[model samples]
Target: ERHRDMRRASSSLLGLAPRLLSGPRLCSRPLPLLAFARASQQRSGDAALALGEIRVADATGSLGVMTPKQALALAAERKLHLVEVAPNASPPVWKLLATLPVVEKRPEPPKIEEM
Candidate 1:
């Protein structure tokens, strides 16, 4: 008898599952929670500028386990060193400067052909 009652209760619960999964029903319009979340997390001018250089680095294999010295060595030929931009991250990303090899001569600008 208890088993039968339990089955009935389970079936009733299952019936309500559809309505629960349907999400919030508000008239005919549904508010976008995702947009609200994004807007709330949006930063102001200063904060945005500060975070512009920040990046998340994912370390997976042996290469991900590179030491700071090794990273510096790898980046030596170029310009900027691999710095830990985000210490909180498992493996921080390194910012490479656009103007690398400062001592090296910059490429010459292309000359426009006159028609």
Candidate 2:
């Protein structure tokens, strides 16, 4: 019985695949390619911050439709800027951090015995 039900469900989903894969319905509707490109650039910029480099990132929320400037001011205090952390969020969130001034710890010099 369970196997029969599984097959039925799978077939139902398969039938809908073509419609789901088809392009958008509106011929004149502007695609979000430009927005996606900008977001990609923003993500690359965020990578620099993750590497401890100084940078400013202006984040967008709600499908990149709304931007709140207050976030930028907060980031500036830390010498950083808001950057998108996850683009998949319904309203993406950003973080502020220094990108250029990553302080890498140096290894201590090895001690040598006097000859």
Candidate 3:
């Protein structure tokens, strides 16, 4: 009786698996494509800067629209990184972010003492 119940449950789960796999996903893009897009973005800081013009903002509030060069200059002056917050906006939105540092840090090689 116990074995029969387990078999029934397993069969039901197997039947539901197909539906679950075919159902609408939370994200429109597939998992692998999403991962690839994220990886590409991380690999290049200029991904957002590639745009002609963007809406820049800071800690206080919006800084208005400006060229990528100008935004980058402003961010450099404040020791912050110019990061894209919204890519879908009309001009795309960029913000001066000091919190998230995107620079890569490489570890120093070990040194050996001479005899």
State which candidate has the highest lDDT.
Answer: 3
Estimate, for each residue in 1-115, the C-alpha lDDT of model 1 and write its tens digit: 9955764576587664423333444763333343212334333222323332344222332334444554545446555444333334555444433332222357999999999
Count residue pairs with overlapping backbones in model 2. Answer: 5
Full-model lDDT for every candidate: 0.41, 0.45, 0.66
Q: Stretches of candidate 1 above 4 Å error?
A: 1-63, 99-115
| Candidate 3, 1-115: lDDT as tens digits | 9955764576587664433343345553212233223423532236656778889888899999988888877877899877666677889887787866444558889999899
Q: Number of backbone collisions per candidate, in order?
A: 0, 5, 0
Which of the numbered candidates is closest to the native, going by highest TM-score? 3
Off by over 4 Å in 3: 1-45, 101-115
Candidate 2's displacement at residue 90, Å, is: 1.8
RMSD of 3: 11.0
Please, what are the lDDT tens digits per residue for candidate 2 over residues 6-77?
Answer: 645665786744333333535633223333324434553324333322323443422233334544445555
Report the candidate with higher TM-score, 2 versus 3.
3
Q: List the residue pairs that clash in candidate 2.
A: 52-99, 53-99, 53-100, 54-99, 54-100
Candidate 1 or 3, higher TM-score? 3
lDDT of 1: 0.41
Number of clashing pairs, model 3? 0
